[model samples]
Target: MAVSFHVRSSSYPSRQHPQAAHVDEQLTRLRSSETASSSSIRQRLSNLQDLHDSLEKMIRLSVTNHALSQDQIEKVLDGSIKILDLCNVAKDALSQMKEGLMEIQSILRRKRGDISAEVKKYLASRKFLKKSFQKVLKSLKTSQNKNNNDALAVFGEAETVTIALFETLFSFMSGSKACGKWSLVSKMMSQSKVTCETDANEFTRVDMEFQSEKSLQMEDVQNLESCIQDLEDGIGSLSKSLIKYRVSILNI
Candidate 1:
């Protein structure tokens, strides 16, 4: 009654369990999915940090540019104001110079008027003397006497001397008209009024010419005076001859 009961051996592979292998594969897949999701989240956070840094840098640059522009504008405004002030000062100086030129012109005009009056008076005196000389010559020529020819010769010499004196006076007057010193001064004054620059060079040239002409005028006056003296001496000699001739005629 002790029957032999043999235990059956398993036919599956002895090295591996099917249920355990399936569980191992599922565990490996879950770990891989978790690693991928963590890497994606870290990349997104890095991108956000970079964007914030760029925005800060842009704001800083904008603030710096605005400050520099404001400083430049202030400097330009200050320079413009200085230039305007300098212009005003220059304008005032020019106005004063013009006024001084006007005063000089007025003085020159008055002096010229005085000179003209003097010339007129001298001319009138010369005319009167010339008429008197002509009358004396006519009386001597009409008279019939032995000494008449000598008297006429002396009178002719006196007339020649008088003519030379008058010619010198006329030449001086003509020179004054041609030179026109006052006219030059007036032109200089007009030029000064129009510009701010100095006209010293031009004025100096005009002054030199005026001085030279004035010297010539003085010389002419001296020559005229000498001629007049000579003429007077000749007239006196002729008068003496006439008186002697009249005494002779009375004696006859």
Candidate 2:
């Protein structure tokens, strides 16, 4: 019975042992795990590459913004320089205007002084002429009273006095060379005032002392007429002279 239970050795595989089978299965599982780990590493590396590209783009943007800011700063600095140049030009123009105003003020002051001096001189000359004429007439009257041939001598003296008074009055009045020249007695009559008779009547009414026969005659009437004509001419000349002088000053 023991001999019938014995196994045949030729039916079993030579390399196939129970321990060896378990080792093969373990090695296959380990290979599959290593392949899965390699796939996970490749995924991590791809994510890192994306992050690096984003960082590079951000850096480029920062550089561009910085360049634009620098350009804006340069433009502001250039504008400031131009503004400063304009300010300097305006300052120069203001200074020149100030100087011009000062010069104009100086000229006005000088002209005012000159006008004041001319006016003073003109007034003094008029005052002297009035005083001198009064004194001359008083002295002639005193001389006539002392003479023995009083009436005849007074007539000659009066005529001489009238002529001298005419020359003095004309010179004081007329501004031009017209004062130096005179016409003869006959020529003067033609140019005389047409109201001579009215003037004589007026003179006679005013001067009561000259109404006496001893003092007034045909010659005295002629002399009086001549004196009246001379006085009228003098007044006209003085008016024209004053007006002309004023006009000349305004022109200057």
Question: What is candidate 1's lDDT per residue for 72-172, written digit by digit as tens?
Answer: 43432333233233223323332333343334345455655454344444444434544543443233221111232321222222222222222222222
Write down the worst ten-residue block by lDDT for model 2: 29-38
Model 2 CA deviation exceeding 4 Å by range: 1-215
Deviation from native of the Cα of residue 139 in model 2, angstroms: 19
Q: What is the per-residue lDDT of model 2 for residues 143-238, given as tens digits with 9 covering 90 to 100? A: 222333321222222232223223323232222122221222212223332111112232232133232313324344344334444444333343
- How high is each candidate's TM-score? 0.25, 0.19
Q: Flag clash pairs in model 2.
A: none
TM-score of 2: 0.19
How many clashes does each candidate structure show, in the order listed? 0, 0
Candidate 1 residue-pair clash tally: 0
State the local distance difference test value for candidate 2.
0.30
